[model samples]
Target: MNPCFFYLLPSLLLIGFAFQSFGEAYETKPLACVLVEEIGGGGSSIPRTIRQTPVELHLIDPLNLIPEAPITSSPETLHLHVTDPSGKLLSPRLSSCEVTYLLPQEVPLAWVRSLTEEKRSPRALGHPWYSLSVKDDASGNTVSAVLGPQGEEDDKLTVFLAVYSTSATLYARLGDPLYVPCGFWRGQQFRSAIEWRHRALGDGKVLYAYDGRLDRIEEIFPGYEMNFSTLQSQGNASLLVDKVAVSDHGTFLCTIYLPYIRAQRDMQLEVTALPTVTFLPNPLFARPNEEITLSCEASHFHPLEISVELLRRLPGDSQFSVLPGVSLSTHTLNKDGTFSLTASLSIIASPEHHGARYFCRVRHISVPEGVTRSNTLHVAGVAGLSLEDGMYLFAVALALYGSLTFLHRKFKLVIGIHESKKDE
Candidate 1:
């Protein structure tokens, strides 16, 4: 023997021992296995033999088996094992096995390589099939089985992995612009359509639809807009609402349709409208010892639950206190789907109430910190004559006195002229 052969002999033996041990270990216990038998094919009547041993075939990372995409940059090894029906190691190992690639009718099997470990790049349009044929050494029996895309032979498995994510909640303030995001992978040269539906309305109303052209249902969903140019270039099918309303609060469904493929995603929208708080008849004036009613209203708010507090701040106090005898009205629904409420405070006006400030503090889901509107009270005396009214009366009396004095002087002058004329 040559010196080189002697030097490489140990390495070769070690490699062979490692491979044999790996095969034995794989056959002894497989992660999973399925028993399969060959059926008649090619218009021939062939008797099928049920094999006891199960074949274990695994496609690691099946998600990467997308058509037109390279299976991997590097070669991927396929691990196969033969085990008995009881999941025990077989007595005699398989003598030979063949792995075949069954291509679609359009693509010939000769174009792809037939190897246990190879980089496979399938055609863009069709499904590639795999088959394993094994022969037991002891019984001289052969078994062949077709491995998955898990359907009938005639059914095409269109692999679709969503490129976008959903199930997130979005918040929008009332009357503000809102954008609902949805995206998908646009296949090459395929006809596609996008539809947006509101699931909260219970009618599944179509807010927007596009099929090579924009379909605007203006009567049902006004103020909704979409850009087809962006959708085509960026695969973005987001819906834009010019103004979000209370009716828009709910789950929305976006569906994308392609040839033999339909993808859908759901999103939630929460619309909040802050309450509009104001006091009715501000700068109120009341007479002492008289009963008066102060009204504060909160309007155009979303949801039915709200809090309206009537607060009072004495003339000298810095902090406000909740006013007594405050009554709240029932929530009134508006045509626009918002709610309104009125809070009233009744009190007997006295001198002590002069220069007091009353506040209407409103709290709602939209504004947790609350909003307050206040009005100042002006209490008049028992006669109900305010300072401005007394000033007005004094000015009127002064003007009357001046006019009477001028008229009296003119009358005296006229009498003197009449007496002089008579004496002459």
Candidate 2:
């Protein structure tokens, strides 16, 4: 008999049992209840039956938050939802229940012993859309509900409502750019116009505009610049401006009002630049006791400043420790057109500096360029005593003394054995 047969039989048996159980649960008439979730520009529906017999579940879409750009959607969660005429329960089994949709974060748990103090009262539901049917076998009572106001339907019945994380956070880097391509169609070849406007940022600060009607602001205090990029066939829009300074940074509104659907967005803009490093590699290959200098350069920027420090990275790793007084050394400074600062690296390292590396730093400068460098200086010398000759002499002397002692012991033992045999 094949040993593999034993493993195959158990697996097949389990799969068959699961399928049989699942089919039985859904085979009966009216489903227990239906759960519907309106989230992430879509809806997920679950059909369930709640009864000793069979019950039906219904899904309602009166709000119509199912299409693109949903508003106040159902949070993703496990909600303890109750319907009108909530069913009473029996130990280990529910009198009546319904499949409900909720953001996982909004799960209202009535199972906890803390419900006596109005626990789970402010059940975290942005809206009340989950409703269902329930039956109480002990009292022969039945409950049903219709989508109504956002709160417990016909209060008096206390239960847990499902919680959810309906909204996802969108992240973006400062000064980074995103494009809204033109493929936004309204039919024919004629392009539809989109306008970009900004408010609450001290008027007249339009980062971009469609229809090519932006007036340049050269004479204004700390002037502004704007440029527009045509979108693909989708009727979208694109725009760019230099600096994106704080005086002009804030919420930007893009409105494309159509004959039917109006589209708009309040995009937040942030400006970020690369850090400038003012350090260099020690050009001179310093043999022990030789002097050399290492250095780098950097410039200052508005709205953000840079920090400079020297780092000596540890061997076999990518981590570095800031040299005790990297910026304390002598250096030169000048600003021809831009803010410039240069530091130097002095070469004469002590015997303890055998593998010591020296460098400079210019940290946290927003220059749209990130730069860094280092210098390696090896101190050449006989740093330690040689053990080869001393160890060689001591080993030879020990070997000879051991051999002589062993020969004397062996001869004495042999002679004693002969003398003893003769006496016997």
Candidate 3:
């Protein structure tokens, strides 16, 4: 064989081996290239800026997120596997890829999960810079890409993590003030429109709306004056419900539209009702030993946190005493969602109890410091007369009899005298 043939043969064999390995590598996509493409950078003269799609992350109500026990840094696992434009999974050795997470200041660093913890693969670039790196394998494969900007970023790929809708339940008296809050997490006061609607009637009645700029609140529905000045600065555009009425008890919806992103919150408002009290057996009359019951009825009230008490006040007493035998019966639910309660107090008629004022008192949580009272019941003595009154009646009867006899005798005498005169 010629000397040149030997050299040429070895070179050809090496080239064939290299081409075969390269073909095998193409069969399985490289994870690093996928990451680079996703992060708006691909090693090419013409940069391929992937159009960053806005992500809508619906979160639970922050108010309800308070952990019952001490909080610890436990990141939720995300089974993330990058894919190519053709929807093919990259290499399983994504372990060799370097990953960086860019987040807005609104989101906490603790909220992010570290993907490297599993096999000690990906590494983060330390505080303030959420950059993670995956070490290259012995075969020399590595991944390097930045997902989003590091800090103070307002560019595309801005993750929108917010509470889609905050659910809240509030109670107020029929005439008390009501405040419903629209919670916008962090300072995400993007350009948006605020709308408040009453969904209770299923008509979606508009209560208020602030257009493109929150310069002033326009009361779409009359009789509502809402304030939204702090919306731009604090992201809290709360609705102020003044002099809440029973008709206002229902579901309310608050909507914030940022053109690209839309959010909503729901609130259930319950307007508490005050009871109307009526007394049964008004102006009660009974014999000395008769048993009588006085009932206090409280009707048309809400949230059944009600109680009825029977009380008695003496003629000269400054304070009334609660009757021991007073009892409260189960409340009845009315068709209008209001409740009715009845309380009764039993009494054995006596002179002392007679002329005593009795009434039923209704108390409820809605009325913090006030109570409703039924009509006063004035107790009359036996047969509308006491023993003393009967004695007086007897004495008056005797005197009337004596006077009648005297008048009769005088009349007879006068008649006799008149007859004699006539005869003369």
Candidate 4:
């Protein structure tokens, strides 16, 4: 056998044994289980089911508490008895039951034998921790009971969180500044660490984390910033996100840490984009008897509730108004999940329509009220009149000239005849 193989074989055996022993030690051998129903009096007992503290079952004092058979008839009392693998029953003690005390401070439990003693105050048990007792039907003895470890939570500190807004959801347009607010309601001085993470992104990308005592900040994303200058002193750890983008939409978790305690709050971000509005064809012109069409397009806007309308400013009109009979039409959605709307206005060009101005008005939640106007169509007017009207005007002028010439000749003939009669 190789020398290296002999050395590695012993190490592998030790590793396997250690793992086997660890698994066996932590195996779920629940000593006591209870089925509790809500009796609904709100006074003392925990309403829902609470299990026995996972303390070592064998370590419990046999004189004070003993294992009994699983109690099926009595649902009011906690069932602490579990049958062994060998089918042997370890009898229960009537004087006491296994109990765990959960209190922020150490308070000695006062064991009572009966509920008829009106002098018993639950407050006497502890300020926050209370005791529940059940009577042994066979022995008529009362056993004081609780769940979890006694005084296990006395050294534990709690961290509380308070958000700045009732609704943690916020909406912002793309390329706009955004703020997500979070703060610690307690333990400012003991605040050891603070973190901001994108929960939707699986928390792999930590936005920011700050160490107060060391006064160091680690910004995971290059552009993201935390308001640690003023907010850190005030127990506020809000993030000021600039030029937010579509990829920034997600639930962000803010965590405040103090020693062994920590708390978190979630804030949701939604990013939307504004549309680009323009006329489809520019510098419009028309002739007499011609039809003119105008299309106003709003492109690349999210949330398809955009309003589009056609407007016209006639000659001598100061303001533009909604042009009647113009219908706004929408087309198929764009590939980027935005919307495009077009409003067309057709005009049968006449002499009266010359110099008339047209507008394409668009309104959306992303922008203020505005109109994009088209060029004034130079329709054929008096300067460039229609061929038929020009021919009619020419005919009327010719008749008037001929009538004037005829009247001059007739007056001359009458004057010549009068002069001849005078000569005779």
Candidate 5:
């Protein structure tokens, strides 16, 4: 054993040396890294450039990577991971980490649900799936990533986006139709559908519906013709309503359901009949206590109801209300649509109040709302002479009477004297 030790020592050392050499060749290496963002690098030869595809990039970065092989001394070139659609090596110049890459295609970002929490998946997917990978030659670091809806981005799809339109709420004359428009998105690869709904009100259903999805206008209504035209986009999914006719007034809603989205808008329609008012001629003249009648009649009302009032331009006042001057009086209108109201204002022989004008106003029966005014009448004033004027007039009259009597007597006496002398 002692003799074999010297001989075996060289062999053992040679085997050890060979093992260490092999280990050195396969040893793990520390990767050089420069912190960078995973964007910028499109139109790249690398089909999976991080700049082009988001899914292909590292979920988190500056993260450690196991060396594919030892970075012995220093590497002549950088090694990175990437998927080539053609399955070949790709070479390209990568941009600095600061720049951003634009989408490769135009994508529609229309979805209703997103209006709430604001889902931007639809906006991010403004293009188709692409690849991305990053390689920093200066720092021996490389990463490859995939981008865009890898499996399902529920928010990115617009296949069945819903749209709708509703008209302003308002009241319309009887036989006027309510306008409502329904719409949905036209998909890139799927067909769209639409239908109807309603709640019954009168003899017919309260709501009206028709399908307007055709090249030429088509009426799906049972006994009516509902038309469809365009009203320019108006910044929403709203479409113009076809002209309106009778039988379409009521509360109605337009609902649109797309492949994966649904939306709706509601409209209320009110219909009324033509309004009519009839009023009697105004009074010629009326004293304060005169019985003044103002007759206003409304036709087409089942039961007639009229309100009579007086308008007075008082000596001093601001606004108008019928009261002591003239006021509202009620009169029931007969089914014949004729109704009259007599209002009495006490007439004073002579009023102290000046320029007190009184006029009768008639609100027709049938319509509780119509009012008419009569011609204005003035309140007459009394002479109102003072005691001083009576005294002056009395004094003048006494003086004149005394003078006339005295003159007459004197004349008679003179005539008598003359006669007596003639007799002697």
Candidate 6:
């Protein structure tokens, strides 16, 4: 034998063994089919039907998974796992499968299950089902499928998912623009009918409605607006209130309808108005040693709950302290669902209190930092004379004295009785 024959023989054997193993693994890989239902249209309504496509389970690329036809109805237990074209679960149950329900955005829908041979299917509820992912624990292979409503084989099927805003409650300032977000994700191709309704009182009222081609805005709902172009192009069915009012504070329902599917979402809107603050008796004046009441009023705020603090900074104090003997009045309800309140502070006026700064600090949900209105105390003298009055009296007396001195000088000059020429 040649010297190199031994090396060549080992290399050829290793290559043959690798190829045999690859062939065996490929042959054992599971094969399944995904069932998809789609609506056909060609200027006329086409009946809905299911189409089947075969796929190698382990060879699927999870990242670039394409959405198949929409599922028309919620999945039954028998339909929990992927099946072959004949509507049968893949045989030879290769270990347990981990199933995850998902939204259109690929977000897990708060429901997950493990499918064993005995417990392979479980019912899911709560949110409208959109997409599903099934993974084989043993093989680490995943397959995703989109779901919609199911209809009869010969009937048309409508596929829809009601997607609500993540935020359940929205706050808007009074007289400001208010946006109520809502939209829908559909598995099939169809025109959408959108309606925005508000329920604040007895019955719900429609603010805006669109029927594919034409839009109907309620005459009573002025300043309500929507962008039809955006809604058609992007499925953005949000409603815009040009100016939010007390009447606009309520629960808003956005409903989207397709041929055979209808879905809706509701959100709460709360309107907040900043209170108008004022100090009663604008020019605060008090007599020395007299008891006086200083009142601060905060009016036209929403949500009822309010906090009032009467703070006082004495004539020589650097920081204001919470004043004592302060009382808040009961809240008064207004016609438009706003509230008004008065906070009073009673104190004895004295010279020490003169020129002191008094602050009325109002706090509410609308104004987190709080609003403050201040007034300076002007205390009159004990003898019923204000500081300004005393200054006026002093000026008058000085003028009289100057006039008397001038007259006396003139009289002396006139009596100049030349009888005194004393040299000094």
User: Which one is best on TM-score?
Assistant: 6
| Candidate 4, number of clashes | 0
lDDT-sorted candidate list, best first: 1, 6, 4, 3, 2, 5
Mark the regions of model 1 whose C-alpha exceeds 4 Å error after superposition: 1-159, 163-167, 186-191, 212-222, 382-424
Task: Summarize candidate 4's per-residue lDDT along 99-140 as a digit string, tens digits.
Answer: 333333211211111111244333323423322222333543
lDDT, each prediction: 0.61, 0.41, 0.54, 0.54, 0.38, 0.61
TM-score of each: 0.51, 0.33, 0.42, 0.44, 0.34, 0.54
Q: Which window of 10 residues has the lowest lDDT sum in candidate 4?
A: 107-116
Candidate 1 TM-score versus the reference: 0.51
Better of 1 and 5 by TM-score: 1
Residue 80 lDDT in candidate 4? 33
Worst 10 residues of 3 by lDDT: 107-116
* Per-prediction CA RMSD (Å): 19.3, 27.7, 24.9, 28.5, 30.4, 18.1
Candidate order by TM-score, decreasing, is: 6, 1, 4, 3, 5, 2
Q: Can you write out model 1's per-residue Cα lDDT over 261-351, one digit (the tens) per residue?
A: 3446667887888888889666577777678888988999986788888888987899889877788889899888888999997877788
- The deviation in Å at residue 11 for candidate 4 is 78
Total backbone clashes of model 2?
A: 43
Flag the better candidate by lDDT, 3 or 6. Answer: 6
